[model samples]
Target chain A: MEEISKSPVSDVPTLADVAARAGVSTATVSRCLNTPDRVTEKTLKTVMDAVNHLGYAPNYSARALAAGRTNMIGAIIPTMENAIFARGIQAFQEELQKNGCTLLVASSSYRQDLEEEQIRTLTARGADALLLIGYQRDPQIYEFLKKRKIPAVLTWASEPSQNFLSVGFDNRKAMKELATDVIGKGHRTIGCISADTATNDRARERVEGIWAAMRDAGLEPDTLQVVETAYSIENGEAAFQQLMSGANPPTAVMCGNDVLAVGALRAAADLGLKVPDDVAITGFDNIELAFVAPVPLTTVHVPHRRMGQLAARALIEALHGRSPESVELPTEVRHRNTL
Target chain B: MEEISKSPVSDVPTLADVAARAGVSTATVSRCLNTPDRVTEKTLKTVMDAVNHLGYAPNYSARALAAGRTNMIGAIIPTMENAIFARGIQAFQEELQKNGCTLLVASSSYRQDLEEEQIRTLTARGADALLLIGYQRDPQIYEFLKKRKIPAVLTWASEPSQNFLSVGFDNRKAMKELATDVIGKGHRTIGCISADTATNDRARERVEGIWAAMRDAGLEPDTLQVVETAYSIENGEAAFQQLMSGANPPTAVMCGNDVLAVGALRAAADLGLKVPDDVAITGFDNIELAFVAPVPLTTVHVPHRRMGQLAARALIEALHGRSPESVELPTEVRHRNTL
Candidate 1:
């Protein structure tokens, strides 16, 4: 663990040293390091032994230049601060690594402009393909990828006719099912806390799904109260407090996602109301917290790992010059103690 | 949103298109794309306009070859499935992007071998610098990074003398302080739940810190029962239940992290045991969930955002050939309803 000098002329062994130690040509050593599968087992073992003994590290830039591919993929998520996207992105990155591709990740904080900027930055740093979340984006982004010929796949929402490779569950349908279940539980009045719907199609779709289900169950859309808030516990708490302060509070609350639901649950507890007895609550995205909440949260469980694995597979297929089929994974209601 | 071919020869616009549209040399266009400051503003604007108009995207490999720096920073963490590392890494990436550097993230899944492989892949993918979560790692990884002269910063534990940059809290001391507060609250018999301590320095340090605090307060270390468990809610509940089932059960429980404490809290509620009345509980790393738990958790708050910002600044400084100082950020106890 000694400090090594920054200069290139330090005592550290170079690729030439490894080649000399392995008793092979420099090109053979280079081939072993860059394309190990192409080398014979005997040669690969010898080169790797020499590498271990001499501690020769490959020059990444030089190797990337020679190979014409960095074997890297870039994934741009909206946020990791929330667990909603973190779990799926983790699975996607693991799948990519298993296939010998490294993942470069960036967060856009739910800003379309920032996402566009990160896409360019990731591509400029030698990502062989891109994995983007959601299908809605600036049209210029699509054009940029088309002009670059970068294999890109979108996840977390599916729109087959858009022609983008999508691996996701139907967000709209998931919310509709959850809303229907709430109605079946004998809750006529429903309140909703959702992220702003103007620019976020997923949020808009979820809100509309709830409206559709409620309307179908004979509840008026106007009677279904809704509040738009940022996706954070603090915001959720504030929105819940506001909802409860209304002259007529709804008997049931449906949150766009689990984080907001957790917040609403906390708010209810703070107000000295018993969950399910005084008011029932429901959440989408059955995250880990939902299972461990004070009261197990009844939620919609999206197939996070499946969607991620499919997205990686699709992107890799696209990179290999094959058209990957889009997939719409399933979502199910997890019955728990809350509702 | 059209399905495009993978080959470079598809309908994609190449750099030649930008050159033609701008009425400039291809070399000029390349230089304008790679090093904007080197070109005149008028010519740079013209090239950018053409790039936008034709949707021309620069090739990553060619750009990395022309510019020695990749503008990519690599981070290797345990898992994103848990929220412990998510917020900090998210903040770190946000800060890095402000300086025009993208983050390349990989998860080791808490495996030493996977971590080593990920380090190699990220380095091979042209990460100019690295941000590792902990100080402990395979010796070969240290040797490889040293041989390559890559600037790396360790996080989650502070070790300044290693000559590697670090931005983290004192894990051992923070736990000791929390244990002291528990003792001060007149709780002698304590049970601890921790992740496997052998490979995880963070968990081990917290456990040892509790033992030391107990010993200092004249309590035998053996009297404080310890349970090693995975950092999951279901596992935490099982462990807590087992502890409570034992004869002479502890009056208080100390968790290695908030995730474990959360499970313990739920188990207590399920058992009809009141927190701090029947049994007291404490947690480390005060995540957002801590505040929203059924009984607000009393825990140590690590400055996640500050740690991220400092780590990014220090790593960026080191990349710029400046010696960045290591920082051991402070942690404070937040008193709530749990303990």
Candidate 2:
């Protein structure tokens, strides 16, 4: 058998090679790469041609040294696959871009330790500020922020004790209002689908809000059904199915968020249960999907975009040495077909 | 009324002041802030107190000079509000984190000009490499990346002419296969709900692929009706309503993506039409919602996580001076209840 001819491996060039090819000083070449706008068009084109021809790659470290700020802001959220923080973070990024900032986002997946590690990485990478989801975290994390003097903003949950600028809706109060609406619908037997409360303060507060509202209405906590699960449509569907399959199924199911509510709706349909007539379903965080569902979802609408904008503004202001106050935006329930 | 006494504004202390307060050299304070691992636990506490008391913020520009690399990567996607890029980008970020790289993400919101601006901003912020969605962008962007010698990989679409490395699926071929399946279902009249094809090469390719498949099946090009709109459920629903309300409504609707397909399904339900019975529906990019839809959507499944991982691996290899070849992953049709 004839031996196969192997393809030759191509080489990637370095910044030094580009500088040599362009017949310019390394600093000039670095300047051209770091601030193209500062370089003349003719020199810029020449340097660019040499780079493309040689397949040159700039050294990021050296470039970072020359530039004062890394165009990065670190944002630690619970999850991105879920819509809860996704939209708000997206909005936050948009606002950041308007101010010429890039957002470095990471999902802690709801682990406090992982979140702290992410913060360290972000700081190492020279992130100027941080946008964290909730105020609840290890005291060491707060101490680290204070020690580093990094401007950090909290979102999704607001805690007065933290003394950090926060842009969020009152999670406990929002849930309480949502539960009141559910009870007003004459749902004495209420079922709940919440995120794991032990780790997620937001989920804990939401469930507590519901329980508090039910108790005030003269309904015992034991009468309310509760299932703690992750914030996922599939999990929501499973939780709803489990609630319905129980000996005493709830007449109304109040979900921790819209995602769970959507799953609950799907599960209810799968079980041949008509919403409103057979089992009323309610969701929180009135995400866009709530409006688009087969039966419009009755849920609490959070001004997520506005919150993101405010958070960005506050962080930017803090960066400029202006002390910005924390903001608590409002949330209201939208009555729809499901409820 | 007594004039409100303004809280005395403390002049923000400099790094020198923080160093003096902590009884450490400026270099020590810098080391403590930059690389805490190098500082003793006792000294770190002292530096932290000084930092918090003085409200001292590190001058990022000075710090950037000392650290050689920014340890940041910039990823520009079309939009985060849309789930199409969500899972893939999330996977990309997860993989990058393992390599000790922070991802700076920006959304262009589907605007070419915005994309260019984001590219410039990311480059200026010292992104070692860039991750871009789709190959179709202003040539200037390519030139800019080349000029800056920023290693960038184009995703979401595969094209050979582009010099940039790519890890993506063949949108045209995938759509052609999906269209073939639609034609095989014995449906002569086909309608399409696509995002604005004018600017989106992916959208255009999908529509053209369907046209090619239909033509190959001995159907006239005019038989393939199309409605262009944004990639949103609400917009998708509107397009489906328009298509169904037409004089010669299609017996089947093929959507450019699953989000649009979901909308079409909802619109069909609203119009009292059953899926696959009255009108079959097919979609592209089988997202999570595709399987969970009331009628499981017949669609094309793109290996999003794999693509993300492959992209990150390629970028890292390139960064390490290895010339990685362009990769094109495959896509397949997922037949479900919709068709």
Candidate 3:
């Protein structure tokens, strides 16, 4: 076995090498590799033995080029530094695996140009379908996918678009509901600490939702102080401090997500302010941290896992030439003690 | 321009089509794509125009198979549900990208069989090198990598293996230092909540380190209560509750990492216990959550990002036929309010 496997190492094994070792034609080897059931049992055994001996691995990209499918699904997410997309992407990968598809993931550092490049790269590597975060890319990318006949589904934000498929929640509605609930508690002056909304539709929609709620409550939405910063606990703390520095500090602070909310809670503790008493705090995205925070955070709960599973199913249907229905999972408010 | 780009789309564009469109031989187009400086300015311009019109992307796998280098590094992590490996892997990827390489990631859910399958899949997909979490796979895997001449580096815990390369911190040493510090703080009765150590060397080493510290402090190490569970905030809370339910609860609860430490803190809050006054708590891996926790956690600070960056550089050197030296980044105990 060692001798058979120890032949002079080439860069990688070619079909011809396997054929030579098995004493068969390269066509027979290729047939055995792709459609083993169609080949005779003895021939299959002979080819496989030679294959194992040579440590031969099928060139996935080469095969993808020939068949136009790599049995692989690719996703480009904004960032992996937090638990924001962790649960959802895990579910997405599990669902894809159940369908005999592997997932290739790349992070874009929340940059649009990098996401565009990742899309092209995944497609070039022969991803049969793609799972994108939002439908906010340049129109040429959609045209490019159309030209290549690759299907893609947008997730995380459910904004209806005639040109794309989506599986997510209405971020604006979720945030608006939370904001309305916050207002019902009789807190007039409010402050917002949001993720940088320039490249993130969810963050923008969420801020808009808060504005709509404030406007509905007879509060001047334009007067509401807002701080846009990168999503980090430290940033959230800094933003909270900035909001509190005003002469008449807002009675409440609403954050874009639970991570920032946790930061605000930490800051509240550090500054010796009582939560829901001295100041109220609310967050979007009820990730684990929301419940585990010292002061359980009041936040919006998005169905992340379900959306991921649905996105996988939708992309698989599209791959099979069936247009899967776009889905919008519901979100709700988890009224914890922080509010 | 639309007409020029609207040629009958095959599954993907081929060099032959680009060559025909440029009215040049395939070799000239290949040269233009691979070594543009070798092509004349006019020829390069014509070839690039044809390439653009056809939306051509070179098949990376095919190129890799021929050259034995994909310029792609693959890492198989235990899971992505936590922040444990996120910061490190992100830094590793950024470093790899700087060296003109792309990263392919897969999570194995800490199952050895699944990890082995991922290793095979990544190699089949033409990963030039692999970044594994630990040196804990079947011996056959090491042999398989050696047979294929695929370079690999173990990370997270620096346990030297003559057969492999490692770039990490000494888990046992770091944990022991923390345990010693807790002991010095005058806590005799100690409890531990750790991630399942059966499959994780890092967790196992930390637990052993705590035991070593207890024995060295003239305390009965075997009397220390321990709970092994999944690394989650809720799990940590439950584990801490379990330890406190014992006939004699420990004066201090030591966690394998900060996530568990946070959970332990939450449990203490719910149980109406004051940290340090009623019970002290210490954690490993000073992730951002440690500092932000209501009672900032005392924990071991591992240089996650630097380890990741160093791992990438070492692997790249190994790939280039240079046997890079293994690095052991320092770890220190961070004294905080928890202890």
Candidate 4:
């Protein structure tokens, strides 16, 4: 299938080949290729035609070998189907580009095995540095990075005690504060729609925070009806329905993220439940969906763009042989109409 | 800054180094690494620890030099801030993965120069195939791809006469059909919110479609007030405000896509204007934002996931030396309350 590219590497057409084909000096061809204004229009056209005829492309791989660095950074995110990681990665790429680095993104669909495979694939492909999401991976991954002398920075979640360089907010604290506020609103019975907590540290911490908040509010943590599911609006709706179907339904619903809350709202409409009046709702991650939803969502806001920019800087500094420190960004609970 | 990676090419540790450190043969080291079950647990531990100590990652570059094929595909999209391109790209990657190929993604921020740069960068990185958006680009790019013998298929837009392989719905015809429907609702004066058409062929075609529909409806095409801007909710809101500020504003507003339509709905709420009652609105690319907005949006549903899958197959087939024909998908206008 890939046979055409199987031509002997030595057979690759060079600039000299193009110059010889066009009957022009290598210097004229180079000038026409890089800075066309130095060459006459006729010379430019002749050089370009020869270039096309020869199918000559400057080999970055060839130069990359010479430079000993490709200046490409790889980012392994969980998924690309939602806006959760979109804004952060955008800012991360922007900062990297400003420093003459390119980003290669590979989504693992939140699977650890796939993530581990990509970690090796990107390394094998020559990524100078990596931007990872969270720090709950097997210690062998850290040892691999350590042995390879590759620098990697974590994002989305933070651990103060760990020495790993990271830029993130306390997901547990943020959700806990939101849950406390929901409880403060006089809703004793609360249901939670959460992403599977086992593989997700962020989801786990957020769930813990809610339990802590429930305890602080003098409510039985077991009384908090929890529905575990994947992160999707459809899943959120189903979870909300399941939680509400219980004989003793909660007075309010708290979701793991804005996507889930939006789904819960959709389910509310489908089930003929009025938001806040029939059941109050809250979410985490103050994404645009939080605001654009039919009922503006009360959620916790994480500085996604800033976190991405800072994470890029940390990775770049680490690549430059600097010991960049971990950063813990704060999250604020945004009180909108839903609560 | 990248000097740490400046170690001599020979300094990279080899399998022999790990074997020597672990007091095992190269075969034992290889088996311990690839098929650990064949080795004793103690041997596995010693080999892994030594592997970590030496940081011996299988050098893909060394093997890639001999293989002449990397089996990597690159997809360059416009932006990551929204969901418009998210689903399509996710599907594209899934199809490529199922075919034993890996996908590398780079965002161009919708800039032509940046896209062109990424095209070169991804190509230089040995992408066997490429999935690009739109058919409108300098023929020089096609020549370069031809010269490199790289197979690339276009998505999102198609032109039959051009002979460029693509998988897309007709943006002009789809939007024209929607405009015809809006016009059929007895709105003579219609205004449009569109993306800047100078650089984007999709936006230009959709605008042209609206004008064509206006003409067919016996209305002066020039009477269609158009606001050209970037594609963002904030930009959409501002453009909607500008278009509606006119003394004799059109009764209906047609947007280039659902993002803008959702923003227009937000603006409608802010301006205390009733949707459809005061001003009817329509959009293209019925993204999730369309359905989740405070007011449900009616939009043309482009087969994004299907297009992604088909485009991946076409590029993969081309990579396999097959002349896959371009497949044009169909679009449908989803009827909802806003229209």
- Could you say which candidate leads in TM-score? 1
Candidate 4: how many backbone clashes?
Answer: 0
- What value does the interface RMSD of model 4 take? 3.8
Please, what are the lDDT tens digits per residue for candidate 2 over residues A1-339? 011111222333666788899998887787787678889999999997776566455543454444434446789887777665778888899888777677888878788888988886686566768899878877767776765657899988887574778888788899999888889889899999998888888888888899889988999877789999988888999999999999999999999999899999999988999998999999998876787676889999988888888998888877666789999999898999998
TM-score of each: 0.92, 0.83, 0.89, 0.90
Write model 4 residue lDDT over B36-154, tens digit each, in one string. 88888999999988876777776555545567667778888888776868789878877876775677777888788888877876777777778888877778788888778788888
Colliding residue pairs in candidate 2: A61-B68, A61-B69, A68-B61
Estimate, for each residue in A1-339, the C-alpha lDDT of model 1 and write its tens digit.
011123343575778999999999999998898678899999999999998777576766665555555667889998998787888988898888777778889888889888988888777777778988888888888888876778888888877366777888788888999999889999988899999888777888889889889889988878888999989877888898899999899889999998898889889988998999888888888887787677879999998888888899898888778888888999999989888
Quote the positional error of residue B196 for candidate 2 in Å: 2.7
Candidate 2 chain A lDDT trough over 10 residues, lowest sum: A1-10
Grade the docking of candidate 3. acceptable
Off by over 4 Å in 4: A1-11, A18-56, B1-12, B18-55
Question: A71-95 in candidate 4: lDDT tens per residue?
Answer: 7788889887768687898899888
Which 10 residues in a row give candidate 4 chain A its minimum summed lDDT?
A: A1-10
Q: List the residue pairs that clash in candidate 4.
A: none
In order, the interface RMSDs are 6.7, 12.1, 9.2, 3.8
For model 2, residues B78-116, the per-residue Cα lDDT tens digits are 887767687888888888888767788899898888887
